[model samples]
Target: MSYLFDHPDKVMPFFWEHVRLTFTSLLIALCIALPLGFVIAKYRKLQAPVTSVLGIIYTIPSMALYAALIPYTGLGKTTAMIGLVAYAQMILVRNVVAAIQGIDPMMIEAAKGMGMSKRQIVFRIEVPLAVPVVLAGIRVATVSIISIGTVAAWIGAGGLGRLIYQGLNHDHTGKIVAGTVTIALLAIGADLLFRIVEKIFSPRTA
Candidate 1:
């Protein structure tokens, strides 16, 4: 309590860095995951193989992933972002595939019977219907990214994790607590924001 009150300035910047890394990684992951997910889902044959590979990627130990990336990407945001994006693939892909799969078959048939093109059906019906599940995946991915972003500090990627590492090195309990608290707050805040967005986009309840 005293530490938090006493070191507000020291803590805020690191917290902001954690937020920045989280959002950046999420954005990049979405860019890759959305299209890839759609592609894999649309092509039934590819679904199993692609998602299986992504799942494998997701399971790689974060520290090991970062260590492997550091050789080429060096120590910084790039390496961290790469690891974060890789981690996001399994969650985002699964959610996306599930969302698309969950859409009613009759609706798709109706669209086809109505002479709707593939693009039209996908954009007009599938995506809108799938948004809720997709958003849920985004929420999960965002939280995962925030948690993993802490590990990035080991490789010199700046974030609240730096504070944790610094605190350990210098035996500063205040910094450690501050960093951990800030990250927990960040995850909670992001989850709430996405929940609001999800509700707004969701169909009105009966």
Candidate 2:
């Protein structure tokens, strides 16, 4: 607390860095997961195998993933981003698949009967109805990423984790506490924001 209030200039940049890393990686993850989820939902045979694979990838320790990527990405934001995206896949993909599947079959049938094209049905009916579930997954991922993103600093990605690491090395408990508290607040803020958005997107009652 003292460290944060005393050194706003030092702490704020790292806080923003963490935010940027989390949001950018999440955007990339959503782009990859959505289409993949669509395909998995469209093809029943692919669902089990593909999700199982993603689950395995997600289960790999974050540090291990970072270490593995270092050879290829050479450490930095790109490596951190890639690791975060990979970690997000299972949650996003599974929720997207489930959301799409949960869309009432009768609703789809009615859309088709109304002469709506497949694309139109997907965009107008399926995706809209699935928004709440997708947002829920995103909320979960965002909070997790905010917390884990601190590790990115170890790989030179430059986040609040850097402060924590420096604090640990220098035996500065105030810095460590400041960094930890900031991240917790970030995650909580993100979760609350997403919940609000989810409600806005959720299907309303008659």
Against the reference, the lDDT scores of all candidates come to 0.92, 0.93
RMSD of 1: 1.1
User: Distance (Å) between predicted and true CA of 48, model 1?
Assistant: 1.3
The lDDT of model 1 is 0.92
Q: Which ten residues in a row have the lowest lDDT in candidate 1?
A: 1-10
Residue-level lDDT tens digits of model 2 in 1-206: 89999999999999999999999999999999999998999998999899889989988888998999999899899999999998889999999999999999999999999999999998999999998999999999999888778888999999999999999999999999999999998999999999999999988899
Task: Please state the error at residue 151 of candidate 2 in Å.
Answer: 1.1
Error of 2 at 49 (Å): 1.3
Q: Residue-wise lDDT of candidate 1 within 120-172, one digit each (tens)?
A: 99999999999999999999999999999999999988899999999999998
- Residue-pair clashes, model 1: 0
